[model samples]
Target: MGTNTRRALTVAAWIVVVAIGVMLSIQRFRDAVGSDIGTDLRTFVAAAEHIRNGRSPYTEFGYVYSPLVAWLLLPFPDFDAAVGPWTAASIAALWGAVAAVTATFWRALSWWQRPVLAGVGIVTALYSALLSLDLWLGQTDTFLPLVAALAVFFASRNRQIASGVSLAFGAIIKSWPVGLGLWMFRRGVQQRGRLIAATVGTGAAFLLLALVIHGPQMFSEWIDRTLVLSEQDLVAYSVWGAGRHLFTQSAALEPLFVAPIVGTIVSWTLAAFIVALIVITLRRPGDDALSMWNIATAVVLLIPVCHLWYFVLALPLLWTWVAHALKGTRRLESLIAVAVMAVWWVIVFRLPPLDNQFGESTPQYIAVVGSSLVALTLSVVLSARRDADRAVVVREAVPA
Candidate 1:
C-alpha cells in the first residue's frame, strides 16, 4: 500500500474504533442522565456544592475522595445536568488510554497485523466487565490508567521528574497509587532522590490545599469513610475475598475451616502471599510494562474493598500482554496463550459479577483479580528468557 493510503486507513480504523466505543457506552450515558446510576458523580457534585456553600465535602454521604477532587468539580453545582457530559469525558479518557498503548507498539507490527491488534483492543474492551460496569455507573476513574502509561513510557526516557510528578498527581486524586512509590525508590540515588522529592512535594501541596478548604480533619474523615476493612465486606472482589469463600459452608464448596475466625486468618495470609509475590518478583531497573502492571495491580488488590471501577487501573497490563504477543520473540505461542487467556477471562466474567454462580462465583472473582497478575508474570519471564538468548548469540559472535 502507498503511504497516503496507509495513513488514510489508519485514520479510518481509529474513527471506527471511537464510534464503536460510543455506541457501546451510550446506554450508560442515558443511565447517568436518567439517574439510573452515577452515584459517584453525584457525590462529587454534591461535595462541590457543600464547598461552594462554605462546608466540608465530607458532609455529603458518599463523598469519600480527596477534598482537591471536590474543589476541582465545584463548577458543576447541578449534578443531574453534569452527569451526561461527565460520562462522555470518562469515555474519552478511556479511549486515550488505549491510544497510548497502540502508539507504543505501532512501529513493530506489519500493516496487516496492526489492524489485528486493533481488533484485539476491541475484544479487550468488550471483555472488561468491570470497565463496562464503570461506564454504566458514570465513574470518573477511567482516567487513572493514563498515569500508568506515563510511568511506562517516561521512566527510562530521561524524564524521571515528569514521571514522578504524574504519579504524585494520581495519588492526589485517589491515594492508593502511593504504593507505586516502591519501584520509584528503587532507581539509582540521583533518580530516586528526584522521584521521592517530586512525589512528596506534590502530595504535600495537594494536602495543603485541601487543608485550607476543610482543615486537617478532612483527610482523617476521608480515610475513615473511604477505607473499609476487608473482613467487613460480606462479598468483596479482592484476592482475600476469594480466600474467604473457601471456608464458608456453601453448596458449591465444603468449608475448609471449622470456624469463621480460622477462615479470616487464612485469608489474610493468602492476601499477604499475593502481596509478596508482586513485590518480590518485580525486577529492579524496573520501568517496563510488566513492572508497572505488577505494582499497580498490587495496589488495587490490596484495597480492603476492591470495586469494579478500580480494575480500570489494570487495563494497561492487559494491553501490554496483547502487545507482547505481537512484539515478543515467541510470537506464535505467546499470541495463542494470550488469546486463550483473554477469551477465558471474558467467559469467566460474562455474567454480572455479584450475581454469578459458577462455583459460588468465587472462581470468577478470584480469576478477575489474579489473571492479569499471572499473565504479566509469565510474559515477563518469557521476555527475560528471550533477552538472555539474544545476549548469548551476541557474546558468541564477539572475538574469542
Candidate 2:
C-alpha cells in the first residue's frame, strides 16, 4: 500500500474505533450512573457516608476498598448523586492508562509502528468490554489498574523507583497490584531488591497515612475486608472460585455437584498449576512484557477473590501483545499468536455475558476467564522461544 493509503487507513481505523466505542458505551454509561443495582459504586458511596458520619468505613460490608478510596468519595453522600462523577473519573482513568502505556512503548518504536501501537491500544481497550461491564456495574477498580500498569511497564524497562512508587499507590488503592513483584524479582535480577525496597517504603508511608486517619487498626481491618472474608466462600471470578462455582455449587451450570473434598482438591490443583507456571516463567528474566502480562493475568485469576472487574487490568496486557507481535524479530510466529488472540477476543466480546451470581462468568471475566488465558499463555510461550534464540545469538557473538 502507498503511504497515503496507509495513512488513510490509520485515520479510518481511529474514526471507526471511536464511533463503535460511542455506540457501545452509551447504555453502559447510562446503566452505571442511573442507580444500577449490583454495582460496587453503591458500596463505595455507603463507605463514604460512613466516613462522613464518623463511622468506620469498613463497617459497610462490601465496602472493602482502601480507606483512601472512601476518602475520595466523601463528597458523594449518595449513590445516585455520586455515580455520575465517579463513572466519569473511572472511565477517564481507564483510558488514561491506555494512553500512558502507548506513550511508553511508542517511544521505542519506528514511526510506522507508532500508529500501530495506538491502534492496537484502542482496539484492545474496546475489545476488553471492561468499560462496558465496569461501567454497568459501577465498578471502580479502573484507576488502580492504571497505576499497576505503569508499575509493571516501568518495572519492565528497569525503572525501579518509578515502578515502586506506582505500585505503592496501587496497593493503597486496592492491594492486588503488589503481585507484580514476580516481574520485579525474576531470578533475583539486579534492581529487584531496589524495586521491593521502594515499594515497601512508599507503601508504608502511604499506608501510614491511611492508618493515622482511619486509626491504626485500619491496616488490619483492610486486610480482613480485602482477604479474610473473601476467603470463606467461593470467589466468583477466580480459577478456584470458578471451579467451585461451576461444579461444586448449585448455581450456574452446575449439574454434577462434586463432593466438597473433590472440589477442594481440584481447585487447589488448578491454582497450584498456575503458581507453578508463574514460578517457572520467573525463573529467569525473559520477556519483561510477556512476563508482566502473564503475571498480572495470573494474579487476577489466582487471587483469593479475583473479581472479574479486575480483568480491566488486562487492557495493558492486550496492548503489549499487539505491540510485541507487530515489532518482534520473529514476525510469523508473532503474527500467528496475535491472530489467535484477536479472534478469541472478538468472540469473547460478542458473546452474551455469562450472568449467574452477578455476571461473573463472562468472557472478559479473565479472557472470558479461562480459555482466553491459554491463548495469552500461547502468545508468551511462542514469543519466549524467540527471546531464547536472540539471547543465544548474542552469547555466540560475545568474545570469550
Candidate 3:
C-alpha cells in the first residue's frame, strides 16, 4: 500500500478504537456512578459543599487536596442526589481535557505520524481495565494524565509560563505534578522568566479563590488538614508500596520506621534516575521534547506510591514515543508498549484487592510478585534504552 493509504487506514482504525473505548468507558462509569466508591472524590465534594455553605472547606471539613481542587469541586453537588450526572460530568470533563491536550500535541507532529500517535493515545486511554477501575471508584486519577499532557504540550511549544501554570495547577490537585516542575527545571526551562511568573500567578489565583470561597482562615486550616492526612498510614498500595508493605509486615523487620525508610529510599532513587535522564537528554539535544517527557513520566509512574491512575500522566508522552518509534519499525519496543497497556488493563480491572483478610494463597503471592516484576523490569529496560540511545547519538555527533 502507498504511505498515504496506510496512514488513512491507520487514522480510520484509531477513530473506531477511540469511539469503542468511549462507549465502554461510559457504560462502566454509569454502572459505578451511584455506588459508594473512591474516598478522594467524596472528600473533595464534601469540602466543596462546606465552602459553598459559607463554611471553611479546610476548617469545617477534612480534605487533603489543595485548595484549588477543593474549590473546583465546590461547584458540584454531593453524591446523594445527583451522583450519576455529577460523576459522568466529571469523567467527561477529565476526558475532554485529555483529548484537547492530545489534539494540540498531535497538531505538532507531521501529518503521517499524527494518526499513529492518535492510535497509541486511544490504546493508552482506553486500556479498558485501568479506566474501569478509575470509573468504578470514581477516582480523580484521570486528572493526572490531563494535567501532565497540558504541561508537556505547553512546555514543548515553548510556552513556559503556561506550562508552569499547568504544573502548579496539577500539583495543587494531586501533589505529583510537582515532579514535572522539577523535570522542567532539570531541562533548563526554569530559567525562562515566564515560568516563574506563571507559577506565582497560579499560586496567587488559588489563594484568591480560597479567600473568596472560605475567607482568610482557610489557609491555616488547609495546612493543618494536609499535615493530619500526611501523618496517616496511607502507605504504599502501589508496586513500590507492595515492597514496603511486605518489608514492614515481616516479623524480622527492624524498628527503623518502615514507611519513612522506604520513602527515603524511593525518593533518593527517583532523584538519581531523574538526574541521569536529564543528563542523557542534555547530551542529545536533537531528541524530541515528547521523548524526554515520556522518560520523565515513566520514571515518576514507577515511584512507590504511584497509583494506577498515575499511568494517565504517561499516556501522552507514551503516544508520542510509540508513534515515532513505530515509524522506524521498532517492533519489539512497540510490542513492549502493548504489553504495558495490557498489564495496566489487567490491574485496573481483573486484580481483586486483598481486603486484609487472613487467607493467604500461593496465587496471591504470584500475582503480586509477577505484577511488580513486570512493572519494575519495564521501567528499567526503557530507561536504559533511552540512556543508551542518547549516548550513541552523542558519540556519533563528535568528530571522528
Score residue 359 of candidate 3 by CA lDDT.
16
User: Which 10 successive residues of model 3 have the least lDDT summed?
Assistant: 353-362
Query: Candidate 3's residue-wise lDDT over 24-54, tens digit each?
Result: 5677666676456755567667777876776
**Considering every candidate listed, which one attains the maximal lDDT?**
2
- Lowest lDDT 10-residue stretch of candidate 1: 279-288
Higher-lDDT candidate of 2 and 3: 2
Off by over 4 Å in 2: 1-28, 127-130, 187-190, 231-235, 256-261, 347-349, 358-369
RMSD of each: 4.0, 3.5, 5.3
TM per candidate: 0.82, 0.85, 0.73
> What lDDT score goes with residue 110 in model 3?
66
In candidate 3, the residue pairs with backbone N, CA or C atoms under 3 Å apart (3 or more residues apart, or in different chains) clash, namely none
lDDT of 1 by residue, 1-400 (tens): 8999988887787677666766766754565566556667778888889889988888887766778677767777687677767777776666666766666667777665566566566546544565556765666677787765665556646477777787787777776777777657442334667777777888888788778757888878888877643234345456655556666664433444556777778668767766665645353322255566656766776776566567667666667667767776667756765765565356433556554222455566556656744654554455455545656777999998
For model 3, the superposed segments whose C-alpha errors exceed 4 Å read 1-11, 34-38, 93-113, 188-191, 238-243, 250-308, 315-317, 329-350, 353-400
Selected candidate, larger lDDT, 1 vs 3: 1
Q: Which candidate achieves the best TM-score against the true structure?
A: 2
Evaluate all candidate structures by whole-model CA lDDT and list the values in order: 0.64, 0.68, 0.56
Look at candidate 1 and tell me the lDDT of residue 204.
Answer: 89
lDDT order of candidates, best first? Answer: 2, 1, 3
